[model samples]
Target: MEDTTQLLPILAVHFHNDLGLATANTLAGIYVGVRQVDVTINGIGERAGNASLEEIVMAIKCRGEEVLGGVYTGINTKHIFTTSNMISKIRKSTKNITDGILKNKGTYEFVSAEDVGFIRASEHGIRLGKLSGRHALKIKILELGYNFEEKQLEDLFWRFKSMAGRKKNITDDDLRALILDETIVPQIA
Candidate 1:
């Protein structure tokens, strides 16, 4: 590989993820002095797809300086998430590219959402379901600008439990509706 790089100084390596080794192979090429790499957004290709731009870029960004002998790419890491999301949208795939981004950005992600042009939505992180507890409900209620006493919170918890049993997931809008429906004083006819 070094000999080939010496011969063709401007050579670029193309990788296919047939056996899920494209990113690994591409990194190997870089280690062997390959100057360029070929990758596609979301790893979309004919069969098993090519090297994923996100995987490769993030791998380099996170490991290049420390592990890959100081080798690095000129990629803007912040545009990665946005680019992946755009490609997913264009391909009409059902995958939520930024779903992980909405939660704790560091769990499965090594980079920041802002680094990849992704603005995390405020309401996107509130995932309420039947399994959610009183604390979660109280937090969501507070986020919606509602303050309730301990007694009120207990009442809301029961109502939320009943509502959650009847629904698959409780959304922010639904939570707002529940608060209004229960709190509003009706005018006597």
Candidate 2:
């Protein structure tokens, strides 16, 4: 990597998240002296998407001084959340075909699940499965109204993975149960 950088002098890194390693690899590039990176907000791109701008920016912001020897980008860290949300809404608008189905009953043939006395299983309607990443799991944890320290989150993540291996879809109930199990202390008489 260093030899190639020496030869090119202006080498850049661009990666896709098909294997969930794009962000990690991009950071590796920075470590190896690559000064330029091609990134997209929320990792939004073809297929699984490219390296996430938010993730890369936050990682550098949080750990660049200690880990990357003070390397940093010009990204405004505060606007990351808003930008991520905006990009998500844009993507959903393009891909979500069920947007009008809920508003107009006559749009689709199937009966409205809500009208049949059915309610959403989770407030955010998000389910974690095997391929889910740590960022997504953390967001879901926050959405579920629980906060864990880094170590606790690491432990919880492994537990979630174990359950996800067996369960096709991990619902809010399942996550709440896991949280309770981790937090509750048993009294020995």
Candidate 3:
């Protein structure tokens, strides 16, 4: 079908993922000069779903220059993560969310989350434990938009130490509560 449509002025491919081949078929269509592709976020569609917008777009982005003769979409890839999250929330499908991209995007993600308008917070990987240092607490405090004096940070550190004893890990939410309840530092914004 793609071969026959190559000579047409406008070519579009509508694919289904019944065999998990929607993305593959879409790529094949593009290679054959298909100008338009039908895709959905997270591949949500009838039955097995359609070609995923993320997968298709990222494929073109990562391979278009080398393989597709520089063919590329005008999409702002950074918003990809934000858009995916919005769609997932709307559909109540949180199972698809993963932090693999957050740690190191290039490992499993083909695109950067920042390109899609999502800003990863500094507290993402910080795990507060009994061995955590005062410097670590200070960094986390600043990252959370708080500016505290040395004395205040010391007080909070002790409070954190007490809490860490009870809980194996102190989460960001817990840290936020400690800052709010114990410290007089004003939130940056």
Which 10-residue span in candidate 1 carries the lowest summed lDDT?
94-103
lDDT of 2: 0.74
Model 2, which residues run further than 4 Å from truth? 1-8, 93-189
Model 2 lDDT per residue over 107-130, tens place: 651433332233444443345788
Question: Best-fitting candidate, measured by lDDT?
Answer: 3
Model with the higher lDDT, candidate 1 or 3: 3
Steric collisions counted per model: 3, 0, 3
Instruction: Give candidate 3's TM-score.
Output: 0.59
Candidate 1 per-residue lDDT over residues 1-189, each given as its tens digit: 356645755768998889999999998888777768999888888788898888888888888887777877788877777677777888898344444433454675566656667664344345778977787788778878999999988988898999999999687888888888778999999
Clashing pairs in 2: none
Which lDDT value does model 3 have at 166?
A: 90
Using TM-score as the measure, the top candidate is: 1
Model 1: how far residue 78 lies from native, Å: 2.2
Candidate 3 lDDT, 20-83, residue by residue in tens = 8999999999998898999999899999999999888888988999987788998988888888
Poorest 10 consecutive residues of model 3 by lDDT? 94-103
Residue 39, model 3, lDDT: 98
Task: State how far residue 182 of model 3 sits from its true place (Å).
Answer: 16
